[model samples]
Target: MAVKKKLAVLFIVDLIIIWFSIYSAYYFRFEGKLVEPYVNQMFLYCAISSVLCGACMAYFGMYRKMWQYASISEMFAMCQAVAIGWALSYAAASVLSEVRVPLAVAVRTLETSLLLVGGVRVIWRVIRLRQSSGMDKRIPTLIYGAGDCGALVAREFKGAAMADHKLIGFVDDARDKLHLTIHGLPVLGNRTDLSTLVEVFKIKEIIIAIPSVPRSQVSEIINLCMASGVQIKIIPAINDLIKGKISVNAIRNVDVEDLLGRDPVHADLQGIADYVHNKVVLVTGAGGSIGSELCRQVASFAPDKLLLLGHGENSIYTIEMELKHKYPGMLFEPIIADIQDRKRIEEVFDTYRPQVVFHAAAHKHVPLMEKNPAEAVKNNVFGTQNVADCADKYGTERFVLVSSDKAVNPTSVMGATKRIAEMYVQSLNASSRTRFASVRFGNVLGSRGSVIPAFKAQIARGGPVTVTDPQMVRYFMTIPEAVQLVIQAGAISQGGEIFILDMGEPVQILKLAEDLIRLSGYEPYIDIPIHFTGIREGEKLFEELLTAEEGATKTQHARIYIGKPEVIQQEDLYVELQKLNNVVLGNSEDLKDVIVQLVPLFARVS
Candidate 1:
């Protein structure tokens, strides 16, 4: 109803403007000395022109636009509508009149009408902008990039009336752009001057708008911004911007992963698609972080069927629903059976007959597994055996076991079990037709039982984020990146190769804690105290990707490497595994010794 009333008012106003323009045109043409016939002609033309112009404007959707946000497009539409209306009016006047209207009069009328219509919208838009700017409580902010992305962000702030930010200026590293002005905001200085500018301008926020730059550079800028103690936000990446997903609201806080300084993983999309496309794929532990991501990536390739097998029904059901929602036509089976249950696992294998299998289910937590060595062996070792044997029996195409860097010179039962699983699968590849391989990498940033969640929880509670050891360091990768490389490893597998991902530089646990605290807007050991707890049982000071026995060799992908570990005899390993399985059932105190017998590098920590 309000919109209708607005349109009515616009129609009446436009009609009045049309009449005034025509009258002024005639008065100017005749020098305010119009004769009787001319006056009659003027009245006829004004009435006809008013109706024609109103119809033209309405048809052009002039009244539908919110004048407050009127722009060049609206002005262009006004010009077209006025020109068409004038032409139609002249035609009607020429056809119906005994006397012809002068071309000068028609031309002058059009000029006046277009000017009035277009000018009014521009003035209204300016008035609205001024009003909004006056009323808005905009925080004084600095944009860190003076490039195209920075310009767009500035425009968004100005054009979006609801935006609660006032851009102070821009800061760019490009020497040419150092002193230039962008969208009325000056490029005050480069990043080096960021801290000084923040103080000088009283900036409450710093928006990093260089989305195309490396994350390492962004992290450096973030660290500099942290010095100012101001709120920081970043624009979405170039791809997100190109997709039209970027907006003022799309800006988000810098996550910990952003500080990793890791380059974006560029996987061979065609290769992955070729491997998983139209194939029956099965992912164990589909509810866990890495496993769930594996399922999602595999499903993207239009697989004939995806089997999400996990011990936990809820996680399996959750991924299943998500996949169903994402790929409605794609088939998915959610199985809730523990991998340790050999009978159930074999039954699932026999039923699904999955061509490719991603064996990710295992006991991975270090401290917890140290206490429950037998359970870790049962799940990580025997459970893997069950799946491997089933895959072998069913003539599966490829079997990839998700191994860990902790498996190298393992200290904990968890690591030992993972090593045994890797060995067993590698040995099984010798006799089985299935291409068995293991993809080894280190800590996934936000996986279950990772330190990130624990640190975040401690920080959220407002105190003392505990670190196991100050000097402890471990390789970290994003779960998605790890999963992508894992799949790529499977696609390129010859069999029995342990593919290791190049997890960049190891991050110190203490520094990680400090950075997390800073990112959370708290000072390490000042606002939020960080306490160092001695390293837990079965924990290592540093993690290794390859042991002395397992020398590294490059693969087709630079980031992935093959570990050339000595091949153990499949028969001998099986005999030892059977003994270990029997010993686990009984309360054997020599479980660590038995693990050492299998994995000579296993260190017994009391």
Candidate 2:
């Protein structure tokens, strides 16, 4: 507190020195030892000007900040004070008839005022340099970009509490900015200097501010920084920035979820709440990511009763506990039962009598599902059928089947099974009062089995981030965002509706790996090796949200679109499914043939 008071006093002294300099410089410029009878009034004018300048400085918050390590806004504040002082001096020295003043003298006074007032800030800056010269600054950091974000980062490091982390300049992809100074920090070359910079400067952290840069590029930088032993973090997306949540203090570690390859798709909170508000809702597979998200979202809609159904007891208990904690007043029943057991599902439907049901139970991993095609068929196909049929039988108002993007002309057994689930819902809708909908989307980023966790695990292990194929691409949406869409889609459901979400553009898998590496603060090739292991079975080069023959018609909601599939006879589908079930159970040799018959274009495990 004493040091602060001394600094404040020093600031006032500097301002006074500037004020007198302006007064004396003008006095000399006029080339006169004032002999006028009203000369004493000039001292009065100086006094008034000094007080007014001080008042202006206060208004601009100049005194609140350290002027020696002042901000650009502070400099602008100084400029304002000087300009106002000159205007006031002009009025005092010349405008009043009682005052003996010349226009030429007033001009000199204005010129000198600017020089002195501006000089105070200039001198203060110099004093800081002198004060800081002998101090051994230790903390080292790397700013990611060479552009405006980099400059903002540099400026922040110059401000309060930034002393712990010394700015070691930028690591940019653009070669043109090499050796350039951004707020006194040099653009120390390209990303190639990452490891070297950390080693040379003993860099402890890297702050990435390139929000608009591709996730792939951002990942590259994070990997570089992380590999170099520098902690890597990024600025939040534009939304967080616009909300003023972004700051040096707000800097956070780079999340592996960012490599999911799409911006957050904003959810329809009201639209979702409208459907689930005070209504009974139940979610199968409530322990799984998609199911868990559905449960959380439904609970937010103020559902009177939320039933959490899953085969895994621990998972069901976990979700039930979480839902209980989050929504104290709401009813949550955690039921542990496999969907394959129709009796258990029927009993749950009878007990809950839920108005809305989200069936998300399924084996989703493509390769795993390929290995256990019968299991995929049983869980994804039969499990969904059992749930949807139970909902229809129980007179549930609506049922939403969680479908996948690979369901669109799917080549994988998992995708085909999910597609079969969609077909079952469509067929079930035809025979029942329940309005069933299938929300088809691609991958949910950060989901239990998603690539994001895999990449994160690999990165955490040090090296060799694996990529199935450099060219592979997939549509991705955040789990929350996807759930939001599913909610809205369920609300807008009509019988037999297959709702497809807008997944934005697909992102390259190889690029995702690269970006994940970068986010970890490692150079892609130099520090973290991205091993391309070739495309896996059931892995598509690019995933589609809709089948080629299917087209989406706009619904009440912008994000949800209705998918029109090739017309199929419900009787025929049921008969075919029965045969598929028998074949899966009896003739394991005919499993591939049965899968292909049920889901055309379904590739058998090679």
TM-score of each: 0.77, 0.68
Tell me the tens digit of each residue's lDDT in model 2 across 87-123. Answer: 7655765545366555565566666656765676678
Worst 10 residues of 2 by lDDT: 238-247
Cα lDDT of model 1 by residue, 487-545, tens digit: 99998999999999999999998988888888898888899998888999999999999
Q: Pick by lDDT: which candidate is best?
A: 1
- lDDT of every model, 2 decimals: 0.89, 0.78
Clashing pairs in model 1, backbone N/Cα/C closer than 3 A: none
**Which lDDT value does model 2 have at 367?**
84
